[model samples]
Target chain A: MIPATLNVYVGLSALLFAVGLLGVLLRRNTLVIYMCLELMLVASTLAFVAFSRFNGSMDGNVFVFFILTVAAAEVAAGLAIIVALFRKRLTVQVDQLDGLKH
Target chain B: MFPAIFTFLVLFTAVCAAGVIVCRNTVNAAMCLLLCLVGVAGLFVCLEAYLLAFLLLLVYAGAVVTLFLFIVMLIDVRGGAPRARNPLATVAGIIAAALVVGGLASFWVRGHLAAPAASATPALGASLKAYAYPLFTAYLLPVQVLGFLLLVAMIGVVVLSRKPDPGPKP
Candidate 1:
């Protein structure tokens, strides 16, 4: 059986992160942008797991747990903000959310 | 065999991630995100982090994606024409992402990758005992702080989503 090298996992993580970044930059809908943010979080978690596996240390896994916790909290707050914004403006488009630009 | 599986998982994840960005329908994008999360969980399992893999599948694919779908439905976003493309933002984002990937690739190719020591414990991957000791002892404070952060986030969500009281009309 061919062994999977560390570079393969790292490269995958990099690609995932780039895709997420592109989505965040290009998407106009708040919900889509939020999904992209979650994608980025997952990408980072993949990297952390890869490092932990190769280095044989549990530190990276521990950090991944903390990242998961923080990401959950962030999503809760972010979705609440999205809902509130939608309630007031009736639109989830980011460009239409420039009320604070004044 | 393992390498083949790993390669397939990586490609699956990349494709799903791209789908999340390229799909116009919000619901479809959210589903694509779910697939991407599941693919990442598979990657975790391939790395032998069983607990983390399950946690990822349960939390991200199960809970987070569901929450996204619920919000998408609640917002009632209809399928419409794609938003106007921002050429400047796309160009800038591509440049930034390329730079980041290129830098990391070069660093990896330069022989700076940390070679794993030969002392890797056999139980380090899937064993809770290996993780519990340090989590409860060395990293206890951060764990406590994490709980506190979650509590605050819960309260903030409630406060932020509350409906405004009706006032007398002029």
Candidate 2:
């Protein structure tokens, strides 16, 4: 049996979210930024499950089902876009691909 | 046994996520993400979300990370170029991130719901029947729409990955 409280789980969620946000802000690699976005999504799911379990409802769990499905599709599409970008520009670094900065 | 496991999972997931940010090599970052997903699955199990936990492992750890690795290999972008320190952007990004962290910390300090007593909390069984009923009932339309969305995504990926025409820049 687990002896932790809800606050503990929420704190973990907050911490992960902060880390993901920091990565998105500071990291220049598009791939790393994308991975950090996924981290944020997963952290949100963890909080959802914790709330669902602690509140004794299935709503949170069901939401995670949808999130997982959507995230998979998002990853597929996003990666395809990244690959296409790489082929067109030959660089995955964000700063080097600045064609629109007039 | 479980709390100890939960603590370990939390630490493992956080460390791996941070590694993704700090690692210069794209492949190394991808590997960190894989480990992070595994740790998240463990955390899901701790929350008793048995099915979601498995799906996370199967979909995220299995498919998504594999796709990332494949892309990294194909592009052969081993390590990111060393960043030139831009003072303005660095300051702005750091300030924005700090604001977000501060907001979340404040939310935890004051706004989070008080956890009810464990014994008083109702038991939400992590069973398939409990999940399937709602997905098939209340969420049926969303499910159908998402199915359509997935098909659209598949078509889009196919279109995007095709070779561009052999013409001049328009």
Candidate 3:
């Protein structure tokens, strides 16, 4: 059984990142957009782990540990903000939330 | 056998991620995210990062995706408003995404990264002790800082979600 090359892993990571970026660009729903952003983060972490694996380093793994920690916190805070915005405005749609445009 | 498994996992993850984008309902998107994360964990296992494989599953699938689902239900947003046939933003976004993907593909084809063979690489991520050593030593500072960041985030969320004071409630 041959191990997949590092390039394959990195390419998969890039593809996922691009998909996430596209979601962020095309979607107007704030929650979905945020999910896409998290997707991008996960994709980067995959690259980090893959690179670390190929290079025989522990740094990337440790970095991913930190990223996981931060992600948990970020999710909490972000959802809270989204909820608050919804409560105040009765909408989570980004286009409608543009009160500063006037 | 190994490449087959890797290819399957990659396809699973990519499809699920795209499912997140294409699914109109928020709940479905959240579920797609969960599945995508699970596939990523499978890929992590392939990379021999056993710890991160489980960590990604535990933190991301167990906690993060659940939170997303809860919020989706609480807010009760059904789906996006089917907008008019304005193709401009959609077309522009597709172009941008394609450009980014094309650039990365070209770089991958042209880039000459001298990666060491996997057999020669140390599987540091396969064990718990290897992880603990760094968390307590050279990377100790970042660990401490992340703890503080978590605390700050908790406090900020509490404040942000607090019920606004209604003046002179009867």
Candidate 4:
């Protein structure tokens, strides 16, 4: 049973990672890309929870809590940066924002 | 019992994740992400980490993802409607998906996974004691720093989202 649960958990996480990767590659909108990034983070959180359970330690859960904290901070700051960038450029298309490209 | 529940949760998460990627509208994608987070929390439950699972739903799905949706909706920018389908990327996604499924099959076949065992400490308070020692002693500084970082992020968001100065300085 634990084996099956872990398999499902890992499988789900992999699916999530793959979906996020696909979104990153296929989507040009920055906001959608940001959502994809969040999906990827959630996938990692799932993996952490699963492993922590597999080990029978609370450490994984605690680590996931920290990950959540970091994710919150990251999204807040990232969205702010994105907002500022949008203000300056009026567009959120990743391909259009080539100013950073050398 | 656990396997059935876990499989259901995994399927739920997989579908939501697929929705997030395949949806045409940004709002729908954000909603899909919310569903994905909830499914992750459900997986947490199967792992016997009930506290972490609920917290996952509350902190992530309730707060962070909603905030993300708000920002996505507020923004005026738009693009990437996925006009004509690209067969190449679609094929690549399918192959990647299949490989992942194969990895799961291999893991299941190994039969080396361990079940939840009896622990010396079972209660949440005991668990907290175990958690807090390391968190307060070894991880104290990083945790405090993260709090400050969150504070700064909040203030930065408020500042950035504020209206521009109305009058020019003399």
Model 3 lDDT per residue over A1-102, tens place: 335778778887888898899889888789999999899999999999999999888999999998889889989999999999999888887767889997
Task: Report model 3's TM-score to 2 decimal places.
Answer: 0.93
What 10-residue stretch in candidate 4 chain B is worst by lDDT?
Answer: B117-126
lDDT of 4 at B129: 65
Candidate 1, superposed: residue stretches over 4 Å from native: A1-3, B79-83, B97-123, B167-170
Name the candidate that leads on DockQ.
Answer: 3
Q: What is the TM-score of chain A in candidate 4?
A: 0.90
Per-residue CA lDDT of model 4 for A1-102, tens digit only, reads: 234445556666766886887788778788888888888888888877776666666666678778889888888888888888888788888767789785
Candidate 3: segments with Cα more than 4 A from true spot: A1-3, B79-81, B85-88, B168-170
What CA RMSD would you report for each candidate?
2.8, 2.6, 2.1, 3.9
With candidate 2 superimposed using the best TM-score fit, by how many Å does residue B88's alpha carbon deviate from the native?
1.5
The TM-score values for the models, in the order shown, are 0.89, 0.92, 0.93, 0.80
Candidate 2 chain B, poorest ten consecutive residues by summed lDDT: B117-126
Candidate 1 lDDT: 0.84
Candidate closest to the true structure, highest lDDT: 3
- For model 1, residues B1-170, the per-residue Cα lDDT tens digits are 76688778878888999999999899999999999998999988888889999999888888888899999989867534456766887788778777867876785677345545323534376888877888999999999999999999999998998888688898
Best by TM-score: 3
| Model 3 global lDDT (CA atoms, 0 to 1) | 0.88
lDDT of 1 at A2: 31
**Across residues B1-170, which tens digit of lDDT does each residue of candidate 2 receive?**
76688778878888998898889787898999899989989877777778888999999999999998888888857445566867987998979877987887798778757778545776464688888999999999989988998999999999999999789878
What lDDT is reached at residue B116 by model 3?
A: 74
- For every prediction, compared with the true complex, DockQ reads 0.60, 0.62, 0.70, 0.51
